[model samples]
Target: MAKYEAKMKETESSVIEFIETVENPKKREDAYKLLEIFSEATGYEAKMWGPSIIGFGSYHYKYASGHEGDAPLVGFSPRKAKISLYFATGDTEREVILERFGKHTSAKACVYINKVADIDVEVLKELINRSIKFLQETYGS
Candidate 1:
């Protein structure tokens, strides 16, 4: 059987150059802040995922049906509307942190925020730590 794959694979693309292309100046600045935060929290050098996402660490995941692929443990994309924070989707601690995360919207796996200043940095750190821990526990580095 053919192996499963993810479209959002890591790339050698320059993250700085990608951030530089963000039309919004504030989003560009926030992208840099997120890069620093995710890098410091995960202790992983950032890499570009696909064309836009700035990913930190990565892990392999296989489902019961055997579909599997590598994915970033934590990452973010500075979109025009909001910053999409990629985190452990089902983590209860993540939900708790998000409650206090300050002015953000969340979906199944992505948290949307307008700016870093719109959220609490300490809570953001906690979320990043929790996501790294959860992902590492679920899928080893």
Candidate 2:
């Protein structure tokens, strides 16, 4: 495996093992399904960003402001309280989704949801795809 994939594997294996041991079978299944959906939708191999996030794809980015790094194209971490989906746009320009999404919260660049059923997965994919295109056009990723 490549270095990044190897590192992610080492991290994500622990996460999958932890999830398997959890008390809630439903949550574990849901998380696994989410991983599958995201993996298929993004067409990126599954890799762990950390203990909880199963990330798909990888890209290198550098801003004109002299900031640059590599990051996953799509990622999510299933936590005890919620699942956090990682994307570039959070609240600044996603007013449409803000009104459409069932019940979700956000930070500067991530979306927090109680469950996948709570939001429109198709719409979410559109947003992610659009964001990726935008990033590529803007940053040449």
Candidate 3:
């Protein structure tokens, strides 16, 4: 059987240069701030994942279907529409925090924010910590 693969793989692409390409000045600035936040929170240097995401730390995951690969413990993408904050989905605490996370929207895998000022930084830090802790406990560091 063919090997299963993860689409969002880490790469050697320059994270700073990629952030510099963000056309919106505000998004660019937010990207830098997020970079710092995730870095300090994860205690890991950021790396480019796929084409856009800035990821900190990594863990390998294997599923029952035999799909397995390495992925960032936590990450984010500063897209044109909004900033996508990556976290472990299905976390009850994450859900609870999002309810009070100021102005933001969330999906199964990410929380979207228009800007850093739109959400609470302390909550963001908590989300980051929770994500890293969850992934580490679930998949090891």
Index of the highest-lDDT prediction: 3
Which residue pairs clash within candidate 2? none
Q: Estimate the TM-score of every prediction.
A: 0.94, 0.76, 0.95
Clashes of 3: 0
Worst 10 residues of 1 by lDDT: 1-10
- Whole-model lDDT for model 3 versus the true structure? 0.90
* Candidate 2: tens digits of C-alpha lDDT, residues 1-141: 433233333243654675575456666777787777777787777776656667777777666785556677777777787878877653345656556767898787678988777888777776677656656666576
lDDT of 3 by residue, 26-82 (tens): 999999999999998888999999999999989988889867888888999999899
Q: What digit string (tens of lDDT, one per residue) describes model 1 on residues 46-72?
A: 999999889988888878887888888
Name the TM-score of candidate 2: 0.76
Q: Give the poorly placed runs of model 1, Cα more than 4 Å off.
A: 1-4
**lDDT-better candidate, 2 vs 3:** 3
State residue 16's C-alpha deviation in candidate 2, in Å: 4.7
